[model samples]
Target: MIKTGLYFGSFNPIHVGHMAIANYMVEYTDIDQLWFVVSPQNPLKKKKTLLDDYHRLELVNRAIGDDLRFRASKVEFGLPKPSYTIDTLAYLSEKYPTHQFFILMGSDNLESIHKWKNADVLLANYDIIVYPRPGFNPESAEKYPRVQIANAPLMEISSTFIRDAIKEGKDIRHFLPYRSWDYLQQMNFYKK
Candidate 1:
């Protein structure tokens, strides 16, 4: 079975940090491919500046460009609101039975993953690959044998920082992936 890694994120604007992690996971690890699963907004809770689902997906596509090793997945778009990890995993597993799906997460996220919906079930069913993040450690990962901490390079960049910079009229072209910055600018997103 092809080993694929699913990197779930809102990708408010696909930044260099997100791209670097995906690239590292795909090229340096056993994962044959990585999918940037662009998370959709929970309709009940309206985030002030969160871009539209399709717009965010478009940014992810531009970030990934023509790389065959990476794909922008919208699996959660057709699913129920308040996307749950377990549900998405079940749906993806059923839809693509030929591929073995693994969850990619940051150390911070792993530390608090038990609080997630059906956390136990999700842990028992699929493997999780944790990458390093600033100010967080994956100490809790030891509790799950399927969870492996990877040595992906530390990326200090964050989409929130980029958004704030744009809103403040700061030039953040290089902070985003190729073509993504231009799109964000043209659409005047996050520049209130």
Candidate 2:
């Protein structure tokens, strides 16, 4: 069976930090492949800041490039809005019967996972790989036996910071992938 880890996020603009984490997961874990499931509308976040779904998807494709082990998925885009993890997982399972799916999340998300739809079903069915985030205690994950704390490099940068930088006329070249940066520049995204 294929060991596929699903890393779900809005990826308003796929940044270098996101790339680093994806690279780290493939190199350090038993996961055979990592799929970046770009969510159309994150249930926990406001939609006002999100770029168009297709734009964000194209950015993700550019960021991943020809990496064999890394993939960008638009599964949620085809699904209903306010996409829930449980629904995505179910859909993925049906579509890829030979793959064992896992959830890749940050400690911050794990801290409030209880608020997610069918959180218990998610935890009970699949393993969770939790990466560290500022102010988030990975130890909180100890209660869940299936949760593994990974020591990936912690980059303090966020997409919000990147968007704000673009709006403020700051250079954010070092924060994003080259191809993605080129597309963002060509499209003049996030400029006020």
Best candidate, lDDT? 2
**Any runs in candidate 1 off by more than 4 Å, and if so which?**
42-46
Q: Point out where model 2 deviates above 4 Å.
A: none
Q: What C-alpha lDDT values do all the predictions have?
A: 0.88, 0.93
Clashes of each: 0, 0
Candidate 1 minimal-lDDT segment of 10 residues:
41-50
Candidate 1 per-residue lDDT, tens place, 16-135, comes to 999888988988888999999988864333677789999999999998899999999999999998888889999999999999999999887787787888999999989999997877
